[model samples]
Target: MASSSRSTLYENLKLVDTVAKVKTTVKELRRQKEISVDCEGNNLSREGTLDILIIGTVNRKVFLFDITKMGVSAFDAGLRDLLESGCDVMAKLMYDCRNDSDALMHLYDVKLAGVLDLQLVEIDSRRKSKQNHWFLKGLKKSIEVYDHDEKSERTKKNGTEQIEDAKRNGTTIWDKRPLSPDLKDYCAVDTVKLFSLLKVFRKKMEREKMLEASERYVDYFRSYETFPETKFYRHGFLPDEILRSNPRDPKVQYNDCQGCKKKFKRARLDLVNAGEKKRANFCSCCSRIITRIENQPIPSQSFA
Candidate 1:
């Protein structure tokens, strides 16, 4: 249940469990310039459950579509069109869109388009300062850091505690029937605060002249294709383009790769165990070659 500070927030929270509701919600969403999007589920990925999709509007209303109940029909009822339209009119503001995009495309055949990922925006905002800019920031931390309003802070704190409690007790909270009030608030707060964070980061990006770079960073994950064979959904997996965009600190020294014996930036090198009591660094290309070679099938022993 939401606390007194957030009691009024519940008024704007709507649950779209039926197909008709999805149609109405999507229609309303189409008129907005941007919408906050988040997915809650049991391990949201290609093979995992996508139980709820939370969408927040600029007017402070949040619509939680019960994916578990409505199923693919939810997508068929204008949800897919709204998401896949790829128009400039409506942008989806999400934190990290990789896993969500993976699940959407693979599960419901919904290709997510026109996404402005706040995770990338946050990273870009910190690039000039070089304060761990390469690392992705989670939504909770972003709220605490960027959108530190009293209401947002309170909501983030309460939601995080409830979510942790649910996890510790082995609860599939998202799959619960007739979703609990606390769970609804938890989902709602994520999307709601995204609008705030987006405003904060957009201003920072514009001031720092990183708007183009930020868009490029988002485009890295905008591809509809999912590489199931690779570690595409890995949390730490970032594209080379993104790695290259990280602002290099003059204070931080570069490393020489053992494989190519070439000087490379800090973020571009990977450390691997070369042998006993020794470690070696390799660049992305060398690492890929090493991985391919190691993964190659051993030649079958000749029985002749």
Candidate 2:
């Protein structure tokens, strides 16, 4: 039960009048320690994790749990574990993992790590994001699931089990609902199988030197800079980062950023040479910092 596994949140969605996409994804991610997971089905324009959030850990083990309709207690227990431990086990857990720190904190109450990303890995592996966009899908296709033992199979719940039982629960599989005791074992088996799948997939990637690629892809998506939506809600980022009320010039030595059309003192070095220039050189903010970057440059040094 270590390679790959996913458990659906059967009634959770119905309980909360929401969709089950979040739980399904979390189940997929929870199994694989070193892998990539995302939900293309969701509308990316949205800001919530309900939109799509892929999580991973370096411990060679990572668990994804979807709690869209879940209560506060369920989240607090899991969140407190990560926050108090201060481990990298929970790397990416937000819709915009890099910039959505505020969202994560509000939801999960934790600070994330600034480690490597799968995007950089993909670049190193010489793969295009477009072609390799469905990395997990490809992996899923490679894995063929079947029954391990017919005798161990549990009774059907929604009848889809019977329709698909032959293909899924052969003489080898033990698939069933988690609500019942007989099926509870089946549920545990799914969770364990997930762990197994991750182990296998991760090993395969590592053995083939493709781990870097996966990591890079994950990183690239994590670092993606999404624009603010109407909600103005944020996660991970501090109060200073979420709002651009006092945006500044990156190239200027010191001063508030002038509007794009205006001009200001140029680089101090350039000013030192002529002592002054009447041509009116614009500061970096006016020329390109604000207009071009439109972001607080990744600070060269972090106090942390």
Candidate 3:
């Protein structure tokens, strides 16, 4: 049986001291094992200040539960738990870990090891450059705890109407405690949905040869040089023309990654192939680069 425990945290923005409980929670989670972790950080300030809120799992349904008594300290414990868990726990994300590392450093103070950063998992996971959305986390449909395809359309409609209101009155997620319930709902769903997608993707991967091929291409982008979020269009790897692809169809015309030095098709993992294959890049290995490199580029391309 999976032990699904939960805790909630009510942040008292008035006192950073109130965040002490977050520290305690980190220690506790470290002792645990095999978890799913996700964080929502509001870029609330012009200085890029963020409110890093996380929803973690032990073994339970990916439903958003309240655990306020545990306090925000639970997040700290989560970071510790994930970091110390070593090779056993693999935390996945839909965005570049580098963008979030600043806020993350506050939780995990040291360089982490024994963790499978899906970012560094493989090269295909990386796109050729900034032009590649293949590296963008959470673009594919791994699974969903709740069917938000309906809600997604709703969010779009609401966002369109809110655009005018947003312009008139800027929003701040920090002072908007008890952390806007709307934000909370969005955050929790994204995390749970990621888990749902993972469960389905893993099963699908085991059954389909083609889907596994896609994952290998996706894995290539997960390396030190590639920004896991947007591997294609590395800072200076490719030409300006290739840097510009049809956002509507990036896979068909994306840039060559500095790492792989080849074309990467990103749209393979778009909405069209959700149930059929794990949305990601396709094969583009340069045999010469494959042979010349000391350390291989994100070569997690698995073809069996």
How far does residue 62 in candidate 1 sit from its true spot (Å)?
0.7
Write model 3 residue lDDT over 25-126, tens digit each, in one string: 444445544344444433421124335444444343232212233333533545444543434454333322333443344433322333222322222223
Q: On TM-score, who's better, 1 or 3?
A: 1
Over the stretch 1-304, how does candidate 2's per-residue lDDT look in tens digits? 2224333322111111122433444344444333322221112222434311223333323233333434244335443333223114533321223333434444444433332333223222333324442122211222233223232233223322533554454421222212233233222323233333444334323322333232322232234244433212222112111111223578754422122222233332121123343222333322223223434332222111
Q: Which model is ahead, 2 or 3, in terms of lDDT? A: 3
The residue-level lDDT of candidate 2 at 82 comes to 35
Best by TM-score: 1
In candidate 1, where is summed lDDT lowest over 10 consecutive residues? 295-304
lDDT of 1 by residue, 25-123 (tens): 787888898888889888787768899998988878888888999899999999999987653667788887777876787789888877777777777
How high is each candidate's TM-score? 0.72, 0.31, 0.43
lDDT of 1: 0.67
10 residues in a row with least lDDT, candidate 3: 8-17
lDDT score for residue 88 of model 2: 41
Best by lDDT: 1
Ranking by TM-score: 1, 3, 2
